[model samples]
Target: MTQVKLANNQWGYISAVIDEASNEVVSLNVSNHANKQQLATTLSNLQATIPKESMPILHSDQGWQY
Candidate 1:
C-alpha cells in the first residue's frame, strides 16, 4: 500500500485487486489509513465478485498493510 496526496494535502491509502492476466482492476478500497482492515475490505469485495472455484492466488509483499 502507498499514500496518495490529494489536492488539499490530505493523504489516503488505496488497496486494489487487479487481474494480471486481463490487465484490469477487479476491486478497490480506499481509506485514510493503510491497515489490515483496509486490505480485508478490498479482498472481500474482490471475493464477492469472483467465483470461489476460480479464485486466483493472492500475493503481497512485506508491507504491513498486506
Candidate 2:
C-alpha cells in the first residue's frame, strides 16, 4: 500500500482493485477528495478493464470512500 500526502498533510482515501485469483493488480485509483463520482468512475473503469467473459470481482475496504 502507498500513501499520498499534500502540503505535509495526509490526503483522502486511495482505492485499488486486485485480482484475487492471480494476485495481480487489475486497476488502481486515487483521489484527494473521494466521492461518488470518483468511485463510480473508478469502478466503471475497473469493469471495463476486466474481460467481459470473466467473472472478475472487485474488493474494497468498508469505508465511506466506497
Candidate 3:
C-alpha cells in the first residue's frame, strides 16, 4: 500500500495486488482512509474480478491495512 497526494492537498491510499511472476497488476483499490476493513473490501473486489479456480496467493508487507 502507498499514500498518494492528489490535487488541492487531497490524499488517499492506494492498495494493489500484483502478480509477481508476470509483474502484472491483478487488482487495485483506493480509499481515503487506511484500515483493515478497507483492505478486506479491496481483496473482496479482487476475488470478484478473478476466477475462483485461478485464485492466487496474496502477499503484503506489514502495513496496518494489510
Candidate 4:
C-alpha cells in the first residue's frame, strides 16, 4: 500500500497484488481512501484472473488494510 499526490494535491491510495514467482502484477486498485473496499476490489479482480482449481496463498505485511 502507498499514497500518491494527485494533480490537485489531493491524495490517492494504491493497492496491488503481485505474483511472487514471476514478479508480475496480478491486480491493482486505486482509490481516494485506503479502505476495505479498495482492497476487496483488488482481490476480486485477482479472483477473476486466477483459475478456480488453483488455491493461491497470500502474504502481506499484516498491515491494517490486510
Best by TM-score: 4
Better of 1 and 2 by TM-score: 1
Q: TM-score of every model?
A: 0.84, 0.68, 0.78, 0.90
Judged by lDDT, which candidate is best? Answer: 4
RMSD, every candidate, angstroms: 1.5, 2.8, 1.8, 1.2
lDDT of 2 at 30: 77
Q: How does each model score on lDDT?
A: 0.84, 0.69, 0.81, 0.92
Query: Per-residue lDDT of 1-66 in model 3, one digit per residue for the tens?
Result: 889898869889888888799898877888898888778887888888887678577777848667
Determine the backbone clash count of candidate 2.
0
Over 1-66, each residue of candidate 4 has an lDDT whose tens digit, in order, gives: 889999999999999999999999999999999999999999999999999899899999946898
Ranking by TM-score: 4, 1, 3, 2
lDDT of 1 by residue, 18-43 (tens): 88789899999889988889988998
lDDT of 2 by residue, 6-45 (tens): 7858676566777777888776777776777767767887
Candidate 3 is scored at a TM of 0.78
Off by over 4 Å in 1: none
The local lDDT score (0 to 100) that residue 38 gets in candidate 3 is 74
Ranking by lDDT: 4, 1, 3, 2
